[model samples]
Target: MLKIDDLIIDKEFEELLPVLTPEEFVRLEQSILKDGMLDPIKVWEEPGTGRNIIIDGHNRYRILKKNNISLNYWENYKFMYADELPTRDDVKRWMLEQQLGRRNLSEAEKYEMVQKFKSVFEQKAKKNQSLGGKGSTNLPKVDTRKEMAKATGVSEGTYRKMDVVMKSDNEDLKQKLREKKVSVDAAYKEVKSTDQKPITVKQQIDRLDKRINDIDKTIESLQVEKEEIIQRRTSIFYALDIKCPVKYRWDKKGYSNTFPCFWKCQIYIENEEYENIFGEYSVYYNEFPSDCDMEKIPETYRNDFRMIWKKAHDEIKALQDEVDKKSMENAKKQDEILKNAMKLIPTDEDKVILKQFYRVLANTYHPDNKKTGNAEMMKHLNDLKAVWGI
Candidate 1:
């Protein structure tokens, strides 16, 4: 492990975008100034790039920069080559090792450290590749169509067409494939055939235009199906709460006796002793609808509620999973957008928009706020900002 004070910030480090929040930067600077950096950041040497790849401590790195603290305080523990950095599998293995030492470090802290290590390695690899000399040359090409075919044991050609079908910006084709209403391969082939051009711009544009129109129609139809699914799911998960008075009143009779109807009720969970001598227990009740005949209620109705609860729980769970999946995806997407936006050499107007978007997302998706809401969904909020302009 290299000491933080011995580290040298390479000129190439200037290329790194500041993604860490100013608060994070300040906190890190404070930590460094107080207890001092506990861990040494790793860097691998890229001979071609003429720079070192950082394997850990990107957050601290940014904080240092924000405080105008130079990197001269730290030392680099360099690997001879960029390929020497750990793979995702290697990181996972190291994480497992940390778990084995779980007696010492809390699980959350260990996971955080592992993630920090992975980020550092990734950023370093990226920097080295971009800066100069060849780094990690034998990295596998990751064209999804080819990889998916390999993984699913499908023919490459078949998968290639499937990829096109999946990505076809055409709404109609997307809908058909999503609904499994049309053979994916067939649609792929048809779209490909239609788009085959005579190598002229005019011809290409015409083919694309036709394809897009077809896609738009498909998307429109698919959207209807999507809406139906949403409605069904909503109904399945619906719960109502009612507390009200009757519109029709009798002058002789009291209000409660006039129109006795069960309304939707609120649910509350309570723990109470079943008997004076018994231990505490939990119960569910419909608070608002005051008069549900618990004895007469059929098992079917009970089961329906149960099913709805399960369905809502399951759907929310599924949505949560998708949120996580999409967050990583969006992170990668935002990274690309940042790279592209950098290419535009953004003017002041773009910069202002980008900063505003970033600030809003940072506030919305801050880790503290995520604890109360859906963390996965909250994570995506930041990614959305990045895509918009950050």
Candidate 2:
């Protein structure tokens, strides 16, 4: 007398069944429509709740409901009860066993089902132990891997590889195994080969030192280039015989701030006679106002001054920014090197070897030896020695 609406769907039990493909579902529905309900829906009565939960025939149940076939009207409609399963864990174990027993399951599916079975068995064993009841004696002590491998029809070694693939983070490899595109041995080898080995402390320190040295060289080169640019800009001003402004400042409250009393240069305009069109104006280095009248000055000299002024200022600013960035990077590298060096705890023998190593480096990089000497390298060697308390 069970109605279609009375059957409860348990998500945990439903997930144990593999999802049907679209084509398979359509074919199943067509078969059911051609015939009547040929098979019964298997359900379990939840002990206290007394609700009938569908444990099998989910696809057939869907087809019956879609066609609106009432159990009362159809004489062949039937329901089979799974009366043996008394607990939820027992139901889960039964569902997993049923899925594992199917002949059409892929190796990946079999492996996954076996893993679930193992988990359920362990949980049941633990529960029995905790309860300390007489039922605990009936539970056999089983070697999980050997028993599962035998049930799965695979060797123990292949079972172990399948376990690795299931536990790995590589989703694509798992899918390939499921689709039978790759064997278990090949997937396991790929995972092992791509794993990175741990880096040692000495190797880490050497890498940091190299990075710091490269940053220092970059900063030194940028400084030299900046100095050359400044010299070039100063030469242009001197060659033009133009007295530029000494300093410039912006005032927030008005022009209350006193402007430096600097000398000015005048521009002569050619128009039948040389006339001083731009009487006198101060030329601030980089703060020259954009709205200034430039038409009064001769075209050639005006263009040359504007070009060099902008070029020098822009290049110097860019160089300073780069130097600042390099300096920050060097600081971080130095900190990392110190941290990695501190991890080393030299033994008595190690200390003796370290002393001899330090002497060789100090002599090679001493500032007094001009050919191979590096003051920066010598400083780093001393810093490391102090950190180690050697």
Candidate 3:
């Protein structure tokens, strides 16, 4: 007597199931249309709510609804309820096991299911400990790696390599692993090779230099944007024929504390036309005694002024904060570059000899000397000195 509408689709439970491919879905739909629901829909009757939540046979349920077929029409249609699963975690474990048992899953999908199973096992273990219970379920012990390997039908070492492959940033490698186009060993080796490549000192300096340049450019851009906002705010104040508030000025000192008072001042009131706008609200000098009711202002001016006011203050503060952060980052990068460059210098004991050698080289290759001058050698010597941070 249960109707299709009576069954609930829990999103959390549904997400645990794999999505069917278009071709697979089409085949399933066609089969149901012809065969008329052979497999039973397994559901869980949630206590208190009394709702039959679909835990299995989601695809069959979807097909049936799409074709407007009623569950009552088929005499063989069955409903298998999961009455023993008293908790959500129990249901999740069951779902994961069902997914692991299916033979259609790709390697990537199987690996992902094992990971989910491991996570659920850990969570259940923690819950049991908190409740002073021991060995409640047959879930694996602390050594999840062994369990994961067994579930995936691979050795522990191979499972470890598979873990590395899954966690790597290479999307193509991951896709290949999923499709069985690449082995876990190959993908893991590639990732390790890429990560193990050492960065030379020169490369490190170049990277730091590039980062400093990028931060400088970002600060410049933010400054330009801040200037534009200030210009717009100035124009609005000018159009209103009122002197711009000192707090609103971009160059004003202690402006952050004073800016909030601008909305309440009699300056916005202008002449008698808007005098009573403040009404019972008292306006004080240089600061508002109470909250400013912005709704009293004329719609045309209020919107524009409020927008520009907020934009001007917020943009300026945000720009300053970003610029300060970038400046600090730039300083750190410059310091790092200096530290790397200093590493090229000789030890203290060799400093005197090294300086003497450098002096002789500089004199011999002096670009300013008419007879001894060798411009190329002088340039090379200077470049060496710069690299050593001398």
Indicate whether candidate 2 or candidate 3 has the larger TM-score.
Answer: 3
lDDT (C-alpha) at residue 218 in model 3: 51
lDDT values, one for every candidate? 0.46, 0.65, 0.65
TM-score of each: 0.21, 0.44, 0.46
Check candidate 2 and list the clashing pairs: none
Worst 10 residues of 3 by lDDT: 282-291
Candidate 1 global Cα RMSD: 39.7
225-266, model 2: which lDDT tens digit per residue?
365355444434434544342221222233221222232323
Residues 12-77, candidate 3: write the lDDT tens digits. 578657788999999989987888777667777754346688887899888878888788634524
Q: For candidate 1, what is the TM-score? A: 0.21
Candidate 1 C-alpha lDDT tens digits along 1-390: 434444455432322223457786677678887875565454544333334545345666555555565544344133434364333224333333433353343222232333223333444444555554455555643444343344333577755666576544456866666455777567877778756743568656876986787576456544643654554433333322321111111121232321222111222122232111111111113211112433322333444333333443344345446666777899999999999988876576887878876666566666677444456756777666556554
Q: TM-score winner among the candidates?
A: 3
The TM-score obtained by model 3 is 0.46
lDDT of 3: 0.65
Q: Residue 338, candidate 2: how far off, in angstroms?
A: 64
RMSD of each: 39.7, 32.9, 22.7
